[model samples]
Target: MENLPKKVRSKKLSTRVDLTAMVSVSFLLIIFFMVTIELAKPKAIDFNLPDNEWTYRGTHISCGPDVTRIVTILLDDNNKIITYSGLLFTPIVDPKVLNYGKNGIRQELFDRRKNITEYSTAIGKPKNGPIVIIKPSKKSNFKNLVDILDEMAIANIDTYAIVSDFTPEESKLLALK
Candidate 1:
């Protein structure tokens, strides 16, 4: 007490938390995501995958004029996938070709795989052919529209896009100018 300073010293409080644990967890999450995400380069049918880094944000990037091999899907007035390669695969009225598989042999996803394996040779590969391009018309039902997507996925049709026309929209904007 005899050696104490003339000015009184105030007590100090500091609540410091170490952030090393949080930084470790963040790094672990980043590594997990990097490992789990598919690293395969974008494989394509007709369109060249854009080199632009800003536009690759969706499951299906839209098709523009640069696209070539496209499987254009048109819906007749009845809204079915009426024409594929100029053939009437889906029909109107009688029998309703689209749902023909509904009442037939019911196969789950597993069953479908087993059958696909058994008939793998019979089912030709699409890799050797013209690149696939999908064109869906307006007014098509969401169900049928998605059905096309499902089939494409099942068929492993990886490289395709839903066709879009830039000319019309661009023309309209040009006219305004």
Candidate 2:
């Protein structure tokens, strides 16, 4: 019997994977996210806060601008906004309930601002915009405050204040309305 040469068996090779590419890609992804986060920082609303005196005085006292230039806005519950010119005690423009939107508080603000500006110019007073006082009642929500703030910005009002405290008389007036 002829002995056949033993067939040579091929050596089994273990699969080897290079992790350098994966590690580099992961590092690139992390760096990309970090750069994006650094570039896209959260935006904040710019506020011009009053001094301690005004804070202590609250909305009851007339400390800010003159009565002629002042416009008070009260934010109540149920998306109701009450606006009037000057102090609540002696209002230049009678208090009227207003809603939110272009036609509601926004229109009133625009008209008031324009009228105030014209009046100031006619009276030879310095051409200054109306001073808006935003008073959010206890029943009011945050959205009301934000909407009023947006109105203030849209109206291009320079002088404005957000007073948390409401006078007793003001509260009564709100209840009546």
Candidate 3:
């Protein structure tokens, strides 16, 4: 019997794959994600802080803020809020207990804003809104403070400050049964 010649086989290619493109693509994706994360970072709120020292008539002098349009809100525990316009001693709108929401504090704020605008216009001044000063006592919760801030935003109040320092008179007023 004649033996048949064995067929020659083609050389087998390497099964291992080159990872250069995959590594480069992965690195590029990582860099893109990092850049996007940096761009998505939150920005800080810009605040215009008043000058600590005031110079008056070529001399440094103490000056008091005009309290006419200033509305002070005292926050107490159990969702109690006492609001008054101007200084406590000589208040434009006497202190009155108010609740949260539209019919309560929101309405008061709207009325005050209207009154203040009219008063300013009558006095030959630009129509200015009220400057609210929120005084949140230690007893007041964070939720109450947030709620008040929401109200301020809802009322479109531009000028307002959260003051923690409570005067003796204000503390006494809050203590009233």
Candidate 4:
């Protein structure tokens, strides 16, 4: 047998994998998702339904002197907004005709709210704003109600009610208009 010279081959190529670019791409995607994602904010109006007692005891719920702070808004036909302040039993401020817009009912509501807050502070009482009573007549459209509700929210009024009953004075006022 003849002796053969053995040739030494280079070590097998290393299979090292570079994961830096993959990691960077993963981080970028995560950042993009974090930046672009928006959380949903729910918009809603809170309403209180009349209880059984209220039904039995008549619709006019007495709110004391706060009644003076109560603002009654009547949604009339042809997008007319009539507003007054005070209780049904007592003499109320004369209903004023108003329009629908930023300068109209919205401004009045804002001013009334501000006045109530200032008056409360001046009288050394806790700031309790007026309670708005919204009465939508059968003649009023649905959009009028929605717009008034939106105005209530925009005015930052925390207390208000939607009463269906129309008192005699309200009826007379409507008739006169």
Candidate 5:
């Protein structure tokens, strides 16, 4: 008998998948989400405390400028704002009694800011504008203080200070209304 040649069959293999592209896309998506979300900024009220050492060159300590363009605001217990401008020694103009609203303190602040800017420019001292001194009386609540601060910011005031002292005259004014 003659030897017959047997046919050999080739074994089939499964398709191999390349996961490199999918992994790169997934990593890119994660990075994109991380960059898009914004973080919240902390809000705070700015306050300055007096230094413990109160002597300047063997004399009483004094701070800030002694100028005419100063606005003093006294916040009273009844949610009333009593405001006066110029030096304390200078004769006080009638204290303006204002409420907290768009047409109240905000309007007054805007008008005062405008007048101060104009006055400074006319006198050739453009940098010498108004400075607001906020004195919140013990009678006043926390909300009142916050409102005045918000008004200052809305009116675009650049210079302001929170002082705790209240002159006797200011105390009397608060007593009026």
Candidate 6:
């Protein structure tokens, strides 16, 4: 090859890379993480099923975190307690409300406690502890509802829930909380 003389001649040049594919991949990874992380996380209260001889029946009511006793209460159309599953039981009894203030509700609560004990004994898991689920009808009066709640509290129930169907109009009723 022959060498040529250069008279201080030079040129400036640059190159650019297309990062569209990399950005697309990064977006896909972000979406995957968001979708999975949102579902995998546990919420304020994780519900767990307790070992109970339950029959397939009316609506189920669950409360509190997983791995604990959760009482399930079933109410009849007449706004009376038909059956309640917990520490106390009245054995397929039609629980009537006297609404005679403290003494009346207390007596009913005592009967509930006795039933629970008897059933627990029959099932060979005798524990005199109190865990009740009060299933009152939507038409039940506030006084009756409060009375049941008070009785449950008096029975030493720290955790329970008032089960009811959610309606659009009733959604605003959340203010009662």
- Which model scores highest in TM-score? 3
Ranking by lDDT: 3, 2, 4, 5, 6, 1
* Residue-by-residue lDDT tens digits, candidate 5, 24-116: 999999987776653334557664332232222236445644244568889988898988777555633446899998998888888778887
2 or 4, greater by TM-score? 2
Best by lDDT: 3
Which digits, one per residue and each the tens of the lDDT, describe model 3 over residues 60-130? Answer: 54564445667999999999999999889988889999999999899999988888778667656554567
lDDT, each prediction: 0.40, 0.82, 0.84, 0.78, 0.76, 0.51
Cα lDDT for residue 22, candidate 1: 100
Candidate 6: worst 10 consecutive residues by lDDT?
168-177
Q: How accurate is candidate 4 locally (lDDT)?
A: 0.78
Alpha carbon lDDT of residue 145, candidate 1?
Answer: 57
TM-score for each predicted model, relative to the true structure: 0.34, 0.64, 0.68, 0.62, 0.62, 0.39
User: In the order shown, what is each candidate's alpha-carbon RMSD?
Assistant: 14.2, 6.9, 5.5, 7.2, 7.2, 11.8
Worst 10 residues of 2 by lDDT: 49-58
TM-score of 6: 0.39
What lDDT score is found at residue 19 in candidate 1? 96
Point out where model 2 deviates above 4 Å. Answer: 1-64
lDDT of 2 by residue, 3-121 (tens): 98888999998789889999999999999999999889987666554322221123534455456677889899999999999777778899999999999999999999999889767
Q: Give the TM-score of candidate 2.
A: 0.64
**Residue-level lDDT for 9 in candidate 3:** 100
User: Which residue pairs clash within candidate 1?
Assistant: 70-133, 71-133
lDDT of 4 by residue, 46-120 (tens): 754222221112344543345556789999999998888766555346678899989999998998888777866
Candidate 6 runs further than 4 Å off: 1-49, 54-91, 128-131, 138-144, 165-177
